[model samples]
Target: MKLLRWTPLALALLAGAGTASAQDKPDPNLARNLAATCAGCHGTGGRTVPGSAVEPLAGADSAVLMQKLRDFRSGARPATIMHQISKGYTEAQLELIAAYFAARK
Candidate 1:
């Protein structure tokens, strides 16, 4: 019957959706992912990047980092690279990434 065939397909889709939602955890690996993107310029874990002017970020103050991020996102801070990347990221993701790095020590 048409109804029976559709019912199985609908159930399979629902099951797949539920599994995906379960996998969407808060991302404790925030530091790892963020570091990968930043390491090219900022160095890993606050180490100074070779031949780069960017400052270290591993043990920076959380408040300071948060403020800087806000500034970058709002055009208050004048950074070419950060402004571009930060613009596309959500506030929550920014906070998580900032906190992950700030709490490194």
Candidate 2:
């Protein structure tokens, strides 16, 4: 009888914990490491070199960055390399990469 009475309370607490964890900020190290692959072309922290044709990604909107990455992964946006490269990462990883670049100066 006691176990049954506590079950709902336990479930609610577990659910709340899950929600709180989900709301926590992502690990910066994870995002940085995942985004490292982009450094070769996008420059360190996604800041393109001066006079480069490549668009600077630093401080770009995360939504825009994520959309571009998704397009590359999906082949909806044609690219010389991004299409193939983007295919290597899962959508969640790509979002992390996007957030990493967006947060950069």
Candidate 3:
């Protein structure tokens, strides 16, 4: 009788545990991590050194960034390497990257 009563409670707890663990946790630093890949050319915090030919991304408008990235991804923009590079990121990742840079000063 004791086992029978506890079995239901145990099963319920196990099921709840599985459900909780199964839910995916979004990374808090995903945008930063993704944007880190651009630091080489764009510079840290999206701010390039003065007089650098590569345009600074810091403080750029998100709409413009999105349009530019989308263009590069779609091959509509003529870039020696951006087109190829942008191809590697998913649409959502691209959005995150653009937003991340847009937020930086």
The best candidate in terms of lDDT: 3
Candidate 3 residue pairs that clash = none
RMSD of each: 2.6, 6.2, 5.0
Clashing pairs in 2: none
TM-score of 2: 0.72
* lDDT of every predicted structure (CA atoms): 0.79, 0.90, 0.92
Write model 1 residue lDDT over 3-100, tens digit each, in one string: 99799899999999999997887666765686567777777775675576898788888788889988988899999788888777788877777777
| Candidate 2 lDDT score at position 36 | 85
Stretch of 10 with least lDDT, candidate 3: 19-28
Model 2 stretches with alpha carbons more than 4 Å out: 1-28
TM-score for every candidate vs. truth? 0.77, 0.72, 0.77
Q: Which predicted model would earn the best TM-score?
A: 3
**Residue 73 of candidate 3: its Cα lDDT?**
84
For residue 98, what is the lDDT in candidate 3?
Answer: 92
Query: lDDT of model 1 at residue 18?
Result: 94
